[model samples]
Target chain A: MTSANSARRRKPFPVHILVFLAPAFIIYTLFMIYPLLDSLRLSLYAPDVNRQEVFVGLDNYERLMTNDLWQPRIEGAIKNNLVFFAIHMLVQNPIGLMLAALLSSQFIRGRAIYRTLIFTPTVLSVVLVGFIWRMILSPLWGISTDFLDLFGLAAYDKPWLGLEETALPTLSLISVWQWVGIPMMLFLAALISIPDELIEAARVDGATAWGVFWRIRFRLIMPTVGIVGVLTFVGNFNAFDLIYTTQKATAGPNYSTDILGTFFYRTFFGVQLQPGNPTMGATVAGVMFLIILAGVLLYMFGWQRRMLQVEF
Target chain B: MKKLLALAVILTLVVALVPATTQAQDKVTLTIESWRNDDIAFWNDVLIPAFNAHYPDIEVIFAPAAPTEYNAALNAKLEGGTAGDLITCRPFDLSLEHFNNGYLVSLNDLPGMEHFGPVARSAWITDDGSDVFCVPMASVIHGFIYNQSIFEELGLEEPATEPEFLELLDAIKADGTYAPLSMGTVDLWEAATMGYQNIGPNYWKGEEGRLGLIDGTIGYDENGFVEAFEALARWTPYLPDGYQAISYPDSQNLFTLGMAAIFPAGSWEIGVFRGQDPDFEMGAFKPPVPEGADTCYISDHVDIAMGVNAASQHQEEAMLFMEWMTTQEFAELYSNALPGFFTLSDHAITLEDPLAQEFLSWRDECESTIRSSYQILSRGEPNNETQLWEVSAQVLNGELTPQEAADIVQSGLEAWYEPQQQ
Candidate 1:
């Protein structure tokens, strides 16, 4: 120990700390925390014709789970969401990871050009992306069909964005196309950060390039994969703008594309026949929050700690 | 004596100048909300300019919303306490609830109340003859729009009777030139609108017909509504194949491209159709009411109205703007811009379109045409119209017989109101 360091450092005053934190704390409380708590309180009630709300704790929740009109809608939305997420995981992330690995490789050409082009869609507003896709897929426009005919798969051409069976999957593909860049960049950073010495050492030990990548590079990036998965799970559930901009509240031919967000919108504001019901709307919102919370908790407890926790 | 004279002069100046300055300061600003772009242009170009010229002190603002987003956005604004000073709405909106809550001022004794034509005024007035809750701006007549050139080419005259109409439809089909009517039922309401138009003539049969089905005095399974449904069902064979899968724009295209002889739609489409095909010779008539009825020509416009907001600080300014809106000048402005719509004002203007001219001439000769009941169903209660849509779709799909579909409508309405009872 150095004998010259004799003075002790004092802890900062609590008031000084509070002064530094107050503005952000106040803003967060007002906008986020209070509104969330208020919504949870509101979900316990039901609307009456007199514009008064009556308390009916958990009855809304119960009815949502079991009611004929509502239960099926909820189940359908969940299934659609899961399918949407799975497609992204299967198609988007793996493609992104491969591209990232290739881009990080020393021999790749025009890396900057590819990166710029791939990341361009991510910067666009979801509404613009939806409208652009809708126009491209329009039968009247015939661009999509014309493109497929070049590959001699003209017979396989479909009104993929319009039909009941293909609409949701097409929308998911669109979402994946827009968002793949985010994970690609994350993987690219992780890939690049691997020290050159480690790969050199493996190569000197008579390892092949593929062997070096699997043994050293892939293992080092397990933490990034975990982060990406959690990000994807959260994003899938919170999605509203793409579906809303494309489908409107009715969500197409027989409500095929209706999701929890549109459901909440219709219930809260009502449509041509149903009057607006705020409490029910709040209940839907509350349930959505709970669903997202449960997802995040699962990610933290099951995946994040296990994969990312480094052992010395 | 000189000092006292100066004080009196200063006092007189203060008294005279104070009110004029205050009145200038109190110049009220009022806003009107609507989703119709054309109507917004009319307000900006014609109504506002005229009103401002009349009352230079008052300022008027126009806030237009997109069509699909209008209702939901308006409701959110109302609930969130940010609605405009004057809201553009239809009669069937829950304005009655707003009136009961004292959000809407009673227009009973408002200046120019007596000028509101009966058809225009009937929607906003209370059933008990208490007060006028809204001011109607225009009346829309709903019926079949047919290509006149096509009918003429086939040597078919416009049908004036139900059997003649069926004959005319078959003749068009036999000619193989066109389908009878092109329709889309994807949204559920198109079929219901068609059903209402078909049922309108039967409505005047007193308590035995349409009224009984609606008010629950007689069950929907009653013979009259069943006949009405069957009448609607007759058109099914004439409709395009895969009609259920088609959207509104697709159906509109079918008609505009002359794929069908007729389209069961609102006269509002007269502008839209003409815009698409300037030479598309088209004419409309009340779908022939039954052979012998008290009111044979039954066609009415759905009500689109304007109201003063409850929270409006400038009620006088809003009312003044509304009063000018229903005047003859404003009426002609709207009529010239969008033909086939009759303004609320009693005065008339000459329409250049031969079909529009014919509609007006027919209305002039026939005074007792019953309005379309679809409009009533639209503004009445929620699910009432939706039930009609669902039942109509069921009827079209063959899952339910006509009478069963009627029963479903009745039961659906009953279920909707039952929650209120609890």
Candidate 2:
């Protein structure tokens, strides 16, 4: 060990580091970077009248941006995607934070059971979740009406999954329910890592429980909050399976529930009657990539300055 | 030079003939790829055994993928050069693209191609009508499947006109014993398929309106198309309570379980209805014509076909099987076994099931046409079929008026279809 260290004391250049990184680098490149670049390349070409692909020099993107056929669809998808992301930030994350804060309390009983129960839905497949929720909201089979009647709210028992106004929100809530566990677990980990002595010291300094949480515990866990937010931003933007599974490929009720992911899938793979358009599909995918990249960069540069971890 | 030429000719002949002779001597296996996983037993137990009795040397395998994944899976298999000798085709553009890519061989010169008429061959033929790729296997006719027991108990006769149809529906609703119509807008396609297309043929005059729309001679906002939407809108009151949330399966169950009196259906659903219960007798009736109209039209849509893979190693054996499919015996076997999928060939076969026979009898009673959005209109940005599904469902949901629904369809078409721009 001494000899190896002495050999590269001034310069830490080493062949072993490259060897160690080879597996991950090769995997990430082949699976992630290569296909992404290829898809980007594919987005630049369009099929002419002869059905042969030709280099169109951003004509595909131009059509997607300006043409009457795609402009509204893309706009609607972006608008819906914003709504989807907002729901996660506004509803999912806050509930997760509250659950974590409560579960972390010393006086709370059955913490493990509550934690496991909340986490169970996260482990279930999105397909199963969509199926179960669709049934639960279904007027014919679901107990939603009966359940509502118990609270004298039977008048509110309209089909949430079928109506245009409520369909997107219903799906969003289903997604939030399945995913709230993630942020809770993350916040819980960060909260437990907090030194008990520090909290005790704050109490000795005549701090209320609420004051200690806001000024001490929450301040210490700010980095986790940033991580949770960004994670949700990425996840919500890429969501397709739940909506697709619940509302078929057309995302019906006049496309009211369509988001960026379902829009891309419909454009790419098509449903019953329409055929796939690979070039245009690739263009949508490229736009998705840019949107995600811009978001990550924004979060990194503007949202948080430091990610100081609590180490003991 | 002459001697050398003769020797080269002899060598080439032997090389070609040797493989042919070797292949003929050994038993050959031909695998078929299909999306009809539901009919696996029908293919294996009835059709394969019958085919083997005639051609004992060739063994056949029936392989299928889930219907939803068939297109992507089939493309991957074809690209990898591992697709089966026989390929089951989805109608129109799906199979047409395969022919364009040289995945399927042009079966124009094949002997049994003459048995099919232009109407049957229209689905798998080239746009210019020079080449036919797939052998037309089956078509599903559109009509109404109703509960016979309920109809008998209510003393309701089959309605022959639109006014009578609505009157019967009113009577059923007044009775309060059963839901008048078993249909839903949740799946969207069910609305377009079983509701709009079922009744629209009488309003649009079928082929003329469909062609006019394609040529831009007819806009969807016109009387024919608008009236179709009006018909769908009219059905709103007769539908089951909470029909907006009811899915395709839910609608089917409502009829099958005797909760609903009538189900707008395709000929494809006959098998499912037959298996429900022995006591539940199902009845079929053609879509009622307009009040003053004399002629009636039906949507006899071509749904499935079979084609040979151009890259198959055993094209000769596969072509033999294709030739046999055109025979009368195969037609009788396929129609009786499948029940709902009426064989496309004009073999004058008898249907054993009363409901299927009744559905088939409408072909002679009405002029036959296909779904309006199927052919050339659906290849663009907002798929015409997909648009119809949305508008038709919304019309039933009361989200859009009939005129607004028609305008949405018309504009969606004009955005891409050139003739519609006028």
Candidate 3:
């Protein structure tokens, strides 16, 4: 009878559970949720002639989409962001997967050393990476040109970072080089988590090594792949530091390297001769937030549904 | 016993509060914000000490931001109501914008302003020429700095006309020993500063042309600007191959290393050039005009000016510092520290540096006019400085003709102006 009474008392509302969740909830609300909501609120206002913020109610967003000075830049940034994401998905992820596969293999020697060397760039500051790459690629110094001349490919050498056609792709590739380590490490962990006995079973049943990898290992790592894809998408869309450090706040050579991150920065802070408008900047941020939210929802609902958790 | 304890606490509070209030009254710190990060040492060692020598009760702090990031940071600080006591003021639109937004304090009744001449005073004055918003610091003259050794080696003289200048560039190019011009358009502003701002005035015919532009009586597609664009295009061939990939610092490196013959820059760069190569003998020449023009007009304008922040807690102290800054003593020190920067004071501060003397000579010899750099005269809508840089870079890259570039600028100006009219 005493036990039944204790059970019916509802465990005193689980004070310990509340205690555990409180810190994280407070932090998340203070840092992330408050700022996000503030930005959304700010998007509804515009600066008047006196530079005082006044509530304009959707005018900023409408102007951002329709204004001559802003519309093209927004569209261009969105397009560049897609290209940036596509490059990572196609090039960075595949290379990471291949490297992970090789490094995780039992036959490969010095796998640990290779892993350490590859991940070194990921730990370096983005500013340092951008500056170092800019110096190495500078045509004035002739470092890149000299390097290319050694293989008799001097004709192919140009100011890749300065040219309008090549600047964005070149920057994207540099970003890929720095970040490929993240996906590689994730894939390597996923690969290691798979029981070796399953592979052995597949091989013993007359399956080749490639077939074992294709049918067994790849199938087991779909969940990790989905996570990596979503992470890459989010990171690519939110990218700013690298482009800003390299090309400056203008994102120029005629704004070829412009992405949503740079666009948002320029709108918020202004660059060169462009004066900042906080209202428009907040509007841009709100749009970006919505886009990212949609992407996250799609991943959770559609991709997560198909991703089966592999049991050991 | 409780009453006794409360009395003890009250006595302790009184003792603490008295000294705190006295200390606050005895000393004040005035913060000065500027974009001249390179001049921190000068401010720390020289200016601060000089200012403190007079007003020992007030301490001065020199806060600096990089030139590229200065405006944005300053705007943020102003918006947050936390800007410094004294603020550096850019000429024209930026200053006007800040004034309109009530970020600056009017200095119409400030002392030492009488020392400023008509030109220096007019720079900070309102459009109606009644109120002054800032105290003028120094006027910088823009021209080409050439390697004296290279000119001696090549037996070249400072050209006095546009044709002569082009001829000199041609000769230098034909020599093939060094780049004729050390200019990097990669930063985009280099071309605008070197070619447009320095040389454009000579083509535009100075103040008359600028006034016409401001009043909408003239356009960028007019004959003067077209000629200026042509002159800029003419200099492109003398630039090094892959010049667009070379940054401003790299271009300076080339000039200092003797890889280039000429560098077009403002007088503010004299100290920089000297620091890079102490023994590097360089000579200055004002941008030459067409042979039949009235006179070669040199680009002269106040480069660094200071104003008191309206929201500052120490307005009286800031005004004191600014008044001290405008004195002849400060002028001499400033000119001594940065050789070629001419003081705004009508008082004759003797020039020690040969380069400063030469620039002074140029000023005396030609019709010196206020520099009408794109932002200096615009309505702040077209952002013509940025447009000029972009179009100038395109011209250098051979992607656009001078005419096409002129048309682009004209269209931008029209787009900005049409809306204002409506």
For lDDT, the strongest prediction is 2
Q: Write the per-residue lDDT of candidate 3 for residues B1-422, one digit (tens) a residue.
A: 23336545544544564444335656897778799898899999998998889989998878787887577567767876667789998876677668768999889888988888766765676776777888888888888899999999999999988889999999999999999998977687877777777888888887777667767777788878888888898888999767866778888988889989998888878888988888999998888888788688887767778999999888899999989978989998888888878887766677888887788677667766675544344455446776788888878767779999999887777776653232
What lDDT would candidate 3 get against the real structure? 0.83
* Cα misplacement distance, residue B336 of candidate 2 (Å): 0.8
lDDT tens digits by residue: candidate 2, A210-236: 999999999888888999999998998
lDDT per residue (tens digit) for residues A9-81 in model 1: 2333567879989999999998799889988999999767665788889998897789755687677777777
- Candidate 3 per-residue lDDT, tens place, A1-312, comes to 999998979667878988999999999998789889999999999878777899999898888889877788889999999999999999999999999999999999999999999999999999999988889988777588889999999889888787778889999999999999999999999999998899999989999989988899988999889999999989988999999988887676777889999999988876565666778889999989988888989999988877755544
Candidate 1 lDDT for residue B399: 50
After aligning candidate 2 to the native by TM-score, how far in Å is the CA of A9 from where it should be? 7.0
- Rank by lDDT, descending? 2, 3, 1
lDDT of 2 by residue, B1-422 (tens): 23336545544543564454346447888878899999899999999999999999998889887887678668766776667889999998889999999999999888877877776787898878899999888889999989989999999989999999999999999999999999988899999999899889899998889889988899999988999999889999999877887889888888999999999999988988777775678888899998899999998888888999998988999999999888888888988988888888877889998888898888788888889998888988788998999889999999999999999999999988999998
DockQ of 2: 0.70
lDDT of 3 at A221: 90
TM-score for each predicted model, relative to the true structure: 0.76, 0.91, 0.88
In what order do the candidates fall by DockQ, top score first?
2, 3, 1
